[model samples]
Target: MSRAEPKTRPSDPRFSSGPAAKRPGWSAKSLELPSLGRSHRAPLARGRIAHAIELTRTLLEIPADYRIAIVPGSDTGAVEMAMWSLLGPRGVDVLAWEHFGGLWIKDIVDQLRLEDVRVLVGAGDIRHRLTMVDWQRDVVFTWNGTATGTCVPGADWIEYDRQGLAICDATSAIFGEPIPVSKLDVIAFSWQKCLGGEAAHGVLVLSPKAVERLLSYTPPWPMPKLFRMKDSAGLLPGLFSGNTINTVSLLCVEDAIDSMEWAISIGGLSALHQRVRDNYQVVADWVAASPWADFLEAVEPCRSRTSVCLRISDPKIAGLDVAGQHRFTSEIAQRLDNMGAAFDISGFRTAPPSLRIWCGPTVETNNLKALMPWLDWAFAEQELHLHQHS
Candidate 1:
């Protein structure tokens, strides 16, 4: 029989992986900024942008020499910008375990039309063996698989003193997860994830090696102003400063700063990580107890602490093919969303059928705790719905 309706619900029912929930006490009024209405390049606005970069450096503990910038086009733009600019000089090994990773492969193979490319694919939640990767060539991979719910265990797999650059898409990691920036050459992420800020801008971090590449080589293709990192003089130092390549949303900038300020007040990165731990534990405990569910990324260490993806483990449901299972799981997600117990908990469109919950730093642990029973209720209800429809 279907389980009785859950007694509690998440207070703020937003569990989407991207554009995650705002901090506990966030308000639109908090975004009322001195730079809001002014030009983004103006003194007040530029200062705010500069402050965001410093906060990012402090929160992420980036090395003193690493150059960081707020680039246009969110995380995708940052990744492609680096790829287009720096990839042609050497062979590249691109890893694709999930949706975003696949996009980077396309950029390298199709867009850039580079012949010397090795695509290492780890479909589903499994990991591509890093041992198989040739680190001598430039390598690009996602730090966390947002869609697959898997991540590289750590930077141990990456060669410490390799000749190639390690370009990483860290959109779903960063603030909630500890990243050894020293292990990476180029890193990209957006404020819309862990920080729960507004979007359309990305943070790009470049190591000294990355800077050397920009100074030494240039892409043969026409560099869109958004992708251009340097001009005839040298690396665009102003990009790392307050000057952006194009106009940026001041509203988003204000929101990003507001979120970072909140993070600082709550003991900074350590505090944010604690919140991630607490929230993930809430789901992990529920999954442990649930007879009907399990983590999509089967390996414990590979599971994402922020975008926690789960699959149905019930034999009857699990036996179905991908499309059929997706329909069933989508129903369960829809029911929870309709009841206002959760929102956008369904897996990504391209990924296997699953429930992907945002257990990021901004999410309150109590909310996830309240969400657990509702998930059970939704699953049971969906089971009954399938029977009745049949």
Candidate 2:
């Protein structure tokens, strides 16, 4: 018996992982009044940036002493800023399970030529191995690995009285996952990820410890102007207050503010958390019943609710060589895209061939429910195409 294509379709299909879908009712008209022609250092422009920083802090429940700054080059920039300034003070532990984490490891081990660095690697979940690390050394890891849909469960395993800083790349997990601000010394996230804002700017949060490190110490290497966060006057206070080191698109700031406002209206962080869970649950339920696919993260607790990755499990699809598997999954994603049922569902090229769906707060649960049957339809179409061609 052959399965018939579902008649119903998702109302919206703009689910790329980064620059994820915007808030349900967002409009370009809402951003028309941004300080387009004025200097970013202009009073009004600076105020807008400061307002965004303040609102983000309030919504995320960051500690009062922790400072927030908007930085250049998105989350990567912010993470590197922390590394360049703080790593040499002590030995460093670099952990990885996926793409972004691996990138940071390379920067610390290869680029910076840090002699005391220790690298820890894992295939899916790296949380369990946190115990083996020496807390006396600075720790760097990703709170959520967007490439593989895995995340550190929480900060429970971290030592409370440890002498090291915890720097996290939380670009995809900030809004959806609850972060223990007290346990983290530095956190970096981009507006483009879970917040559904425009790209190229990052939000960097620093604990008092991180700030102290910056003020008291500096990397031996000459830092780029874009990465400089401190000077003779001490830490650049204005950066935290929205006087950016470089110009930013006022339009993007306006859009970020709009998204943050929408998040607040919908009940802040708790609501955002529930939104992602509900969206993930929709796909989770489908995957539970669908024999053709399964989540890449075998450990349920470690699976990411935002970037949900699904691997083809059926032997017919899974038996193919890596190149063939990529082609098959590409075909499925392409078929779905052509049908307007989904967009950008292909897994990261660096990752194994699979499908990754964005289940962040901006993605509607109803739309995800509407999408599953279409996924089934697409899979069937791909199977039939491969059978005929072979």
Candidate 3:
């Protein structure tokens, strides 16, 4: 089958990196509001936003004093907003293991043009090295690198007593993992990932310290109207509670709310964590059985439970060098997609060539099971084709 062919329906295993699988029984009709077509300033939109915030707070067990906001531009908006607002006041340290964390390091060191910035990057499979850095500086990192399938185990690596604030981009890891609330000062996520809601909106959670940073310190650069979090300070009582800047899809908001409720009813964070862990095991078992498959993450403990990345390890493929291996892997991914076995399993462009599978809460383990045979079939087909061509 060609890429043009509708290979799989929505009911088929959806393994797309973002806009992941939605929770079972989640429906847009449940969130339908008469004011969906009305201005965002309308009361109905505010009510939906309020309900979403409340549900998120309950599902994640956010602190009573913290504030949550639905912002523009998804996870990127949330992270950039936090960096623009919070990093200039203190020395900043960025911990990078993969693409998302790399973006943060670039923003701090290059985009923001901050003079006092340090970036700690780990090579192949190693999570960011946080040792030897002064805790007095601001810290920014992604809790999970969706591309590399690696993650920081928890906030325990952060210096809880330090004067610095810890900002986390938990877009893919938020609901799937356990993040200790007190350790994080600014937490940002998008609706698309684990929550499996629509794109275009982000959820920003601000600890008291993060709020203080925004209120007290202003970055040297002028902040855009959309990035401005302070104007809503007084209005924030309503902003955090009900008022949202732009109109959100009442349907998407309802879907997110339903997803959160589902998370809670099924056992909250613990259950979600277990689901991700279980999904990882499915991939792990596949890796262990196949000599051509091994986790990209160097350390087992630091490997991500949500995004599970694997490398092909056939001796012939390895003998061909990195470029040949990449070509071989790309061919395999294409074959898998054409056969309706997998979609979007190709490793990210910036990452080393490998297969990256998402093992989030909504992804069924049975789908992963189904995928293994397809992977084996595709690889074998590729090998046969290579032999014929040679």
- Kindly state the number of residue pairs that clash in model 3: 0
The superposed Cα distance between candidate 2 and the true structure at residue 206, in angstroms, equals 0.4
What CA root-mean-square deviation does each model show from the true structure?
1.3, 1.2, 3.4
Q: Tens digit of lDDT per residue, candidate 3, span 254-333?
A: 77877888888889889888988888888888888997778888788788888888887788777787888889889988
- Runs of candidate 1 with Cα error greater than 4 angstroms are 123-128
TM-score of each: 0.97, 0.98, 0.93
Cα lDDT computed for each candidate against the true fold? 0.89, 0.89, 0.81
- Measured on C-alpha atoms, candidate 1 has an lDDT of 0.89
Candidate 2, which segments miss by more than 4 Å at Cα? Answer: 1-3, 32-34
- lDDT string for model 2 (288-380, tens) is 999899998888888899999989999998999999999988888998899899999999999898898999999988899899999999999
Please write out the lDDT profile of model 1 over residues 1-390, one tens digit for every residue. Answer: 667897888899999898999988999987857787799879888998899899888888899899999999999989988898889888999987789999999999999999899998854434455778888899999988889788788788888898999999999999988888898999999999999988899999999999999999977888888898898899776899789989999889889988998999889999999999999999998888899999998888778899999999999899988998999989999999999999999999998899999999999999998998898888888898888887
